[model samples]
Target: MADATADLAGASPAKLTTADGRPLKSALARAQAKARRRAFLLVLPLLLFIVLTFILPIGQMLHRSIFNDGFAANMPQLTQWFVDNPVGTEPDESAYAALAADLKSAAEAKTIGVVGTRVNYEMSGTRSLFTSTGRKAKNFEPPYMQAVLEADDKWADPQLWGTMRQVSDAYTANFFLAAVDLARDTEGKIVQAPEDRRVYVMLFERTFLIAGLITFLCLLLGFPIAHLLATLPLRYSNLLMILVLLPFWTSLLVRTTSWIVLLQGQGVVNNTLVATGILTDDTRIQMIYNQMGTIIAMTHILLPFMILPLYSVMRPIPPSYVRAARSLGASSWTAFRRIYLPQTLPGIGAGALLVFILGVGYYITPALVGGASGQLISNLIAFHMQDSLNWSLAAAIAAVLLAAVLVLYWLYDRLIGIDNLKLG
Candidate 1:
């Protein structure tokens, strides 16, 4: 018996083998490794697609926000002068000489316009200053300081010089400052933009305000509809679900245009109200092309986003829990607050986050429906990208918006555990 016990101890579990005479532990590990490899292979294409499409574009946007070489690349002489001199050092004779050389060189190279436009971003009306000066800078005589200043007295303007110093670098945060309705003065001190020039800040505020209001409206409007879908018979629920999802099949333009037609002053809504004596023709509400229009249209469009998440969560909650609470002497509101609402919290959080994000980033809806006051930050970003042709400023604004969204996301994660979010 002692010999047998010793034999059993020597025959350890690690030494065990499978029926096929393979080591059991190694065989199980090999199977697990193969399964992991298969799973990775299944997801590889999605990983590549995300990196190529999403990650690369965001990386490019961040790079573009701080980089613009138009002035530095075209006006090498002036860039070198700025490099040699520290910030706040008054420009001397060599600065003027370098300016003259660069202006003349840029003129000859036909890149003076590029340099001027770069400077023009910081100091308005300087494009013409550079263009007109470039025309005479080529013929400048010695003591180029006097010569260049003589060509254009605007060159003597301290603000103009201050702006040039800031723009001399190929990379700068001036664009970002401008995006936030702030700017660095000639002395390199940050200051608020002039009242008339301040726009982006207000638009950003409006964007967030509208996004929050829309999310609230969606939650109010969507909650009951989701409950109906969750509690109704399967056949009826599926039909109602189709109605909810029908918007996704329709073209966005068609839906937006439909709202325009319905809500416009002379459209069906106003006409009906007038005919019903609810409103006079002259007193027709101005719903389209304003904040009301944006909110109404956006709420309708994003309703499905709220409803779907809610239904996904609410559907799985057994009705008996709330019923059991009621049977135990809980009032209807008490049962709902204690038992039902807590379970729905995950869906509410998910839906609000999704809707708010989509609302903040929405562009085409606001652009088409939003008039002057209704315009969001996205509209301003578009203006910089398409109309003003200041991609750096646009990128800066986008980056700021992205940061705001991230901070909001962080707050949400802190307030409500992100892992609690229900998607299905």
Candidate 2:
């Protein structure tokens, strides 16, 4: 009808006009643009808030992951020396002279700590070497190479020079390499970290492994509960739903600590079994402060996420469909497999993805109950951020985790079609 009207309007000698004698098409276009502008104005505050709180911080994190100028900014002469020389260049007397000048200047300016920290990231224990040397660099005379080496034997190491060269510039991928348990040799070739120091990769693998287990457990434990809730009558379902959501009202710390009280060696679970004569007190099972603890606590916390989505999808599925299949000479299992199960796939996917993502990043519950064995990569990231003050490396680890999540989302979207995801 609209096309026919347009044809008629085109064939007509007189152009279409509004009541105000303006062209109708132009008037409609103007009204649409005005409406769009009004809508944009209405949402402007929300857009600004998201940009400020979410987008900007993520941008800063990405930037920090690649750029750090603590060393280059403070040690100008040494950084200039690095720029002038090639990768394999050996530091001669001139090099030590430049280092001595920078150290003395950095010491006087009180920026020696910053310079030391950047190098310390690459070569641990060099922070004190730089600071201690900086204190005495002012008295160093000609033949400065001898003076510097005499002050600290570490100053003579070629590997230390290679590291200083690496951090000479404001930007580098070394932090990212360190995040994955890799580092560079004195010749600038990348290689695996020492066996004892190869930790980040292992932590990353453990993190995903635990998250996958948590997601599977949540699905396993939640599927029956969700089905029960969906099939039960309204009065009972509401009561059950309140139980499921009750955790959300309580503090997460409280829930985790409560689990600690129940799962510890002498805690409620062990005491109950001992009292019931199921097990002796000396034979109590070790449940807390290990991978099992992390898995159990996380599964309980994330179970509601799985249930709500499954329940939402399941509630709308008509019981008659299953009964009809059963009446059509199919058994209950066969009917569910052929009809009911396929209907809940969206909820399963949504819930699994939600629980997995949350489990991957969980920290507090793991910290309280996980102990040494259950700690995840986030704990290492926190260690870098809080204890070590290595914000650049922390940001790099976070960036890698975010990249992994995006890759998972991409693969899920490719295989299952993201449009099918349904969350309550």
Candidate 3:
């Protein structure tokens, strides 16, 4: 029975083994495993580097989007007031007195202003109410709620105070709510933006449009160049390939600045056009500081990304396929179209995807070339970080960008099959 049990256990063979029936019992097997372990250990530094440098920062940024404390942290006194005031029909004088004293303290300390701004973004006119009460509270004596009501009857509405009570949580979905230009009601319902503030939805639409246009332009401009480079003799193709890669040697800032210089009214392009009498001086195209400038610069920058992928793909396709099509009585264009284009579709899809993905999150090129009307979503992200000093809002925008990238990647993988992609 013990022998059978030992045989059953041994029936599961070792993972590493010699060609013969013996398992990996020799020093060579041990040495191989040791080498593999050493190889894994060698890569450990890179694994830790990626986790610490890339993954942790992204995780932390995403966390901040829903982990804000602006309202709850600053308005502890307000929350205490609400808790002390029971479900009674009338407001209690004792709670009201405490609230008045606390409001005065919050005003002087600027905590009320902080909470007020957080609330006003959701509930309009809340800032004015907070500031007015906080600033003027020092003059009011005991029974200050009555004095507060006398100053602004809005305080007694209960609706205003109820709204305040509803939003006393440490974490909120406010940033995500504002991203799509909606806000939550007192009952935690999604509602459309107020008429005057309906800009974000339009901005989101504009961002997608710009990204799509850039993708189209990259594909169109890149396909022909990639085909030529892939098909031509090595002597000539190598020279052309150098030109394609030359842009990478130059600084991106330099490239953007060069576009600005060339495309501006008093710049080289307009000057050349006017001098050539192609158009009147008054009609010199106003290209810079506009959407057109953004498109032109971005297309130039991303075109190479499209070309490289397509070129790598087309180079490997044998010339005999086109020759065979022609031998079958196909015209040159027909042979190229039927035989060549289908083959290049994989490359085209890959190039288009790469360019589109990169173009979506572009910030520097757009910021430099694009004016107020031309700013991409990334520019708005930068604005939240710099001007508003709202790190949570910035993180929310970044999270949205990341989610968009993930969705695009998922759709691409589903539609195109990343496993079938051939880099060469």
- Say which candidate scores most in TM-score: 2
Arrange candidates by lDDT, descending.
2, 1, 3
Give the lDDT of residue 162 in candidate 2.
Answer: 90
Model 2's alpha-carbon lDDT is 0.94
Output the worst ten-in-a-row residue range by lDDT, candidate 1: 8-17
Q: Report the C-alpha lDDT of model 2 over 1-424, residue by residue, as the tens digit.
A: 9998888668643467788988878888999999999999999999999999999999999999999999988888989998898888889999999999999999999999999999989888889998899999899998999999999888888889998999998999998999999998888899998888899999999999999999998999999999999999999999999999999999999999999999999999999999999999789999999998889999999999999999999999999999999999999999999999999999999999999999989989888899999999999989999999999999999999999999999999999999999996
Candidate 3: where are CA atoms >4 Å away? 1-36, 80-113, 124-141, 147-163, 422-424
* lDDT by residue for model 3 (12-45), tens: 5454456674566575777899999999999999
Q: Which residue runs does candidate 2 get wrong by more than 4 Å? A: 1-14
- Candidate 1 per-residue C-alpha lDDT over 261-355 given as tens digits, one digit per residue, 9 for 90 to 100: 99999999999999999999789999999999999999999999999999999999999999999999999999999999999999999999999
Q: What TM-scores do the predictions have? A: 0.94, 0.96, 0.84
Instruction: Kindly give the stretch of ten consecutive residues in candidate 2 with the minimal lDDT sum.
Output: 8-17
The global C-alpha lDDT for each of the candidates, from Candidate 1 onward, is 0.92, 0.94, 0.81
**lDDT for 238 (candidate 2):** 100
TM-score of 1: 0.94
